[model samples]
Target: MAIYRKLEKEDKEKLVGIFQQPSAMYDYREFDEDALIADENCNCIVIENDGEIAGFASFITYRVPTKGLVGRIEDVIVDEKYRGQGLGRGVMEKIIEIAKEKKVSLIDLTSNPKRAAARKLYESLGFEIHDTGVFRLKIK
Candidate 1:
């Protein structure tokens, strides 16, 4: 059986290994050791399958000033070999529990349009597709 737990300070090397992929869901190029180990607002959870890190989810909680308190799912990644399993759902469910504890009124995330399965997972978990436009400027 797999175990879902919070990232520990000792898990840095393993976590970095998971984040090092070029096509990772989150940009961890500047992933800092201190933040991963001590940041109160950062919650990084990992799933261990037979003592190996198989997947991870990072969440951030913050109040958008006038907009109110909200939680944002920074990233969710499951190993390619574990894709068909319900690890992603487990990650989200755990995050939802944390969000509720933090009194977050809303939780949001942005997913690639090409990730159809991921979209379905989010939608089934009660996340709605809002009719809003998002613009980004990439730096080279």
Candidate 2:
């Protein structure tokens, strides 16, 4: 059985293992379990298969002057071994549910063009791409 639920402290080791998978697009950042759990604005969902972590997704809600409350989904992934089993969809659906519960006015996420499958999933979940440029400044 697969269980989808909020991330718990005990899941850190397994979650870190998932993040260690190589991704040309994303670099692994230090996992701040305490910060994630302490911050009310951050919502993280984890999928557990049998006794191991199988997938994870998260979103952060913030107040925007023009849009009211909005969310940005981030770090969605399923274990490589668990791919093609609908775990990604299940985790994403759980994130959407959290967004609805928080009354978020809008939810946004960015996916690399190379991630065709991920982009397709987002589109199927009603996320439409807006014609806008994304700029980032690496401060670190």
Candidate 3:
């Protein structure tokens, strides 16, 4: 059985493991314990199975310029061994609840076009692809 819950400090290593997976696009290569602890708007949730971390989701709520308030799903991933077990959905549901509680007016996320299953899951969760383009350039 899997359980979705708030990430505790002791669980930092486990949370990092999810981000460290080769397939994970979370960009946690620079993630540190202080980052999670110091950001009040950041919420890290994890899905654990029988004491092992299997999936994770990270969310951030903030007011964007011209966008009042919003909750952004920074990342979501379920370990390959646990993908079909509803763990992804479960973690997303938990994150949604957290967003609601935080009173975010909107929730946003971007997924790779190749991740059809993930896109479907986001759609089922009421997320839609906005008609806006997302771009990025690494400063380093």
- Candidate lDDT values, in order: 0.76, 0.78, 0.75
The true-versus-predicted C-alpha distance at residue 9 of model 3, in Å, is: 3.2
RMSD of each: 5.9, 5.6, 5.8
Give stretches of model 3 more than 4 Å off.
133-140
What tens digits encode model 2's per-residue C-alpha lDDT throughout 51-95? 788978888989879878888888898888898889888887887
TM-score for all models, in order of appearance: 0.83, 0.88, 0.83
lDDT of 1 at 122: 85
Best by lDDT: 2
What residue runs in model 2 are displaced by over 4 Å at the alpha carbon? 23-26, 133-140
Backbone clashes, candidate 1: 0
lDDT by residue for model 1 over 5-92, one digit each (tens)? 9887677677766666655645666867667758889898888887888888887878888656778887688776677788889898
Give every collision pair in model 1. Answer: none
Q: Write the per-residue lDDT of candidate 3 for residues 1-140, one digit (tens) a residue.
A: 88987777787776667667777746666666677877788887878987888977888878878766777786788887787888998998888777777777778788788878988888787776766732111111
